[model samples]
Target: MTDTPIFQPGDALASARRTLLTEAQAIETLAARLDDAFAEAVRLLLACRGRVVVSGLGKTGHIGRKIAATLASTGTPAFFLHAAEAVHGDLGMLTAQDVLIALSHSGASQELLTVLPAVRRLGAKVIAITGNPQSELAQLADIHLNGAVDQEACPLNLAPTASTTAALALGDALAVACLEARGFGPEDFARSHPGGALGRRLLTHVRDVMRQGGAVPRVPLSATLFQALEEMSAKGMGMTVIVDDANRPAGIFTDGDLRRLIERRGDLRGLLAAEGMSRNPRTIAAEALAVDAAAQMDEQRLSQMLVVGKQGELIGALHMHDLMAAKVV
Candidate 1:
């Protein structure tokens, strides 16, 4: 008997290409179908007085969790609840003022169907995202947004491929739409992602991470190099800003300069800050974001930078260590 042949290289490549094209087509179909139902769903969610309760099962549950996270991070308060878990007592998390968004490709997820009635009975608004608008979950919802795809990207047409992607994209659209309607800003996004780099960039200002006022390692130009070194040691910032009599930043001295001076056998006690410091050192505005200051430090190849006010007066200092501690870089 002849053995069934395995897929050849050309066949495998063709199959992958077909799958990608199929999924892309499915996404296009889903996008074109978006309309007023999408708007209504956004309105219902916005009108909600409490958190959005997202529920689904199987692959839909994974999609639901992402949708909930997107909603939460984009200004909407939301959380995911497994429908099966909800029926097993997690339903207590839902409240009368909450809005329920149920995800099911068939609009007939048995677990969601089982607990959805309870969600509605509790006076929560129910919004369903499913491929079949005529399916039971859609019929039960107060608002229904079609997440229909033309077909599955799976060759067997069984696995949740194109359908799942379509649903996930639709949910993202809803999140962004609601986010725009609420005028959600970077600060609001940062609040939801406080532990991430984007959050640090948006929330960390110079004031939050700078060595301020007396804590800044600063000295007048007339101060001896020994005094500047002492100030740098006391502040533990590895550098010192040299200011003029008017308190304007005139120059900077770092550990590197001190090393160079020592190598040249220069007397640390006899040299003044003006004679030893690097004139017109790279500086940042006091109001600059910590991330911007970090970039400036990187570009200048410096471990520390001076923070100056509008009139170029030294207000504080930023060190690479401070940026690292604040996660600004």
Candidate 2:
């Protein structure tokens, strides 16, 4: 267990609020400074045939790497290269088809200055993100993005706090603009992130994860309790859909229904499924997203649901465990 701190909660809370407000104001300032240059940078990136190459130094380099990643994941092909290494023959990565986004808060990093001319000569356009608009980098680049901040969130105003935030926000703005301009949709995002749970949520459908045909555990409405129990045990999904003569679901029988019937009558030897099953059980469509099915299960506090078609015919069954195995949850 952790011990209590020396400072009072009220004082600490006040300081935290001040820090957040400071960064908010800094972002507001950057937003106001955004101009036609921002749009021009967007246009340059959009027209580029090759990849986007991002470079920076130290903390600004960290921000650049993240910016590059965001851009790539959002359908803009991009990668990061260290500014210091660019001068040491790393410049071979550049070509006329590529675009370079150089990040330097001061716009005076020696390493970036050393390679800017070479990158330009190689025919790759440069977009400089710098706080000092008059600095060499901003002056030399084809387009200058004004990432200036009023002050750092630090009390000493020496660390790269608010400045980095402004740069990151601006980078995010550019990536989103590019994403929208290209009409990149969720399906495209899923393709980019296929290994994560988010990918399963966006890419998977109920039909893909549902148990269909003979795999679906179901019994007729007239099936006896013993018969329904046998089907549920055989399927091992802990529930069975009770269907009518036309193969449409009229009700459902689950382990919970068995427990309730046992408590109410203390015996179910001669009971039929229609006598004990819950009528009008909620259902989901087979065409729905698997994540939507998970949401419905959680919302209804159920472990399984009958999957049906638009015509109210039983097509399959979806279980909570299926969603778990598919990583939709």
Highest TM-score: which candidate?
1
Q: Which residue ranges in model 1 land beyond 4 Å of their true spot?
A: 1-7, 211-216, 219-222, 226-238, 243-251, 254-271, 276-287, 297-303, 308-315, 324-326
- Residue range 1-329, candidate 2, lDDT tens digits: 35976778999899889889989998999989999999999999999999999999999999999999999999999999999988888889888999999999999999999999899889999999999999999999999999998888888999899999999999999999999999999989998998876788898999989999999999998899999999999999998999999889999999999999999988778899888899987888888999999998999898998888888999999889998988899
User: Model 1, range 1-329, lDDT digits (tens) per residue?
Assistant: 35987868999999899999988898898878888888889999899999999999999999999999999889899999998999899999999999999999999888899988898899999999998989999999999988888779887789999998888888899899999999998888888888888888988898789889789888887899889988989988888888888888888888888888778765666788667678888888877789888887888788988888888788888889999988787
Top-lDDT structure, candidate number = 2
Q: State candidate 2's TM-score.
A: 0.78
Number of clashing pairs per prediction, in order: 0, 0
Deviation in Å, model 2, residue 179 alpha carbon? 3.0
**Pairs of residues clashing in candidate 1:** none
Question: By summed lDDT, which 10 consecutive residues of candidate 1 come out lowest?
Answer: 265-274
